[model samples]
Target: MSDPWLMPDGKTKVDPFVEECRLDEIPFPVWFAPYTKGERLGDMLWTGGSGLKIASQRMIDALQDAKITGYRTFDVDVRDHAGNPIKGYVGFATDPGPTTDIQNILGQDGQNFVFIANQRVVEALRAHGADELDIRPYDPSEFD
Candidate 1:
């Protein structure tokens, strides 16, 4: 099964992802669906929907230890494929602080947003392994 809000006919019944959400619009302590696939490894992870920044506890600790800013963390509850509780994870959000003027990056999935991670974030993501982000430079002018 896909996300709960996904219909069998390939449509979504609810707004997908927390990307454009305002602070008050989202419920604190985000809840994730059962993770039934993959090794569930990586300090940073991607879910099918609900695009909150899911980071492992080690990543969170590293971020805090480095005094990273412009983001907030929320508690999250996740269960493995077998309904086993998966601990040591949290959801986070950033405020787009201190960005350069080379603006408006695009996501590989045009419908979603992709962001650049700095050295601090890269270091944090290395808790398990290298960040496996799909980077595709998009220049929207080609569509014109």
Candidate 2:
């Protein structure tokens, strides 16, 4: 698959900041730059990849419980830079059927990060030189 990092024409990419995190070792703190129009928190940590994975599994479980007749669901979780709960995370199934085609476009990895925060916090982080954003489909499923 093509590298999402190089495709910026509104296509999503992983937050380099999250990838740089040491998921298995030390704590990872990421600052969210508050620039969007309508958000609450100022700074926040996009979920680590592992966090996303966990959330994905939960989403799948929820789908199963509801008897949703679609792609296999998944779950993931993430914390903010200050070790606070993340806005949300996302996941897609690996089933190679047309029903799961959209999931394929979400990235074969079946994982993504969605950060949420108030504009002020984002502004502060930008002022403080925070870089690498994991911007993508900032949906309620992941951010709400």
Candidate 3:
């Protein structure tokens, strides 16, 4: 049986990843706050889409560079007053491996925003900010 939400035309469910992988996809309000500078696995929000074009452009350019690997994007839920994720936004991070040009993006903001890289990405994201980090995984069946 197929899910009712599935399209009547039998269109397969598309993964959110398909959108982020696009070369032209640009996210907004992306932040680069401070992160724990050490050996640890973590994630970061490359874009929050809060009307900040500069921040978003920096992240996009970095990601576009061929040097970045393990680049993946996920739909992080940042809710507003009504409890809805702000539109035109998404979060991204690379695997726990060093790469080039990452510093350019991180260093660009300086103290204006924390340079959230690797280990520090999660903490910096969850820290005092309008964009909340919804990195925690959810399994609907587990709740059911």
> In terms of TM-score, which candidate is strongest?
1
Tens-digit per-residue lDDT, 1-144, candidate 3: 855323334564322222233323323232222233343212333223221111232333345443343344554444343444444444443322255322223333211122224433334334423233344433346535
Q: Rate the local accuracy (lDDT) of all candidates.
A: 0.53, 0.36, 0.34
lDDT of 2 by residue, 1-71 (tens): 75533323435444532343322321332333222344343222332332232223333344445443324
Candidate 1 residues lying further than 4 Å off, grouped into runs, are 1-30, 34-36, 99-113, 124-144
RMSD per model, one decimal = 6.5, 15.0, 14.2
Tens digit per residue, CA lDDT, model 1, 24-102: 4443433565333667466556656555556677766766776666556766666665656678877655544455211
lDDT of 2 at 48: 35
* lDDT, candidate 3, at 4: 35
- How far does residue 59 in candidate 3 sit from its true spot (Å)? 4.0
Model 2 error, position 103 (Å): 3.3
Per lDDT, what order, best first?
1, 2, 3
Residue 37 accuracy (lDDT) in model 2: 42
Window of ten residues with lowest summed lDDT in model 3: 46-55
Q: In candidate 3, how many Å is residue 15 off?
A: 23
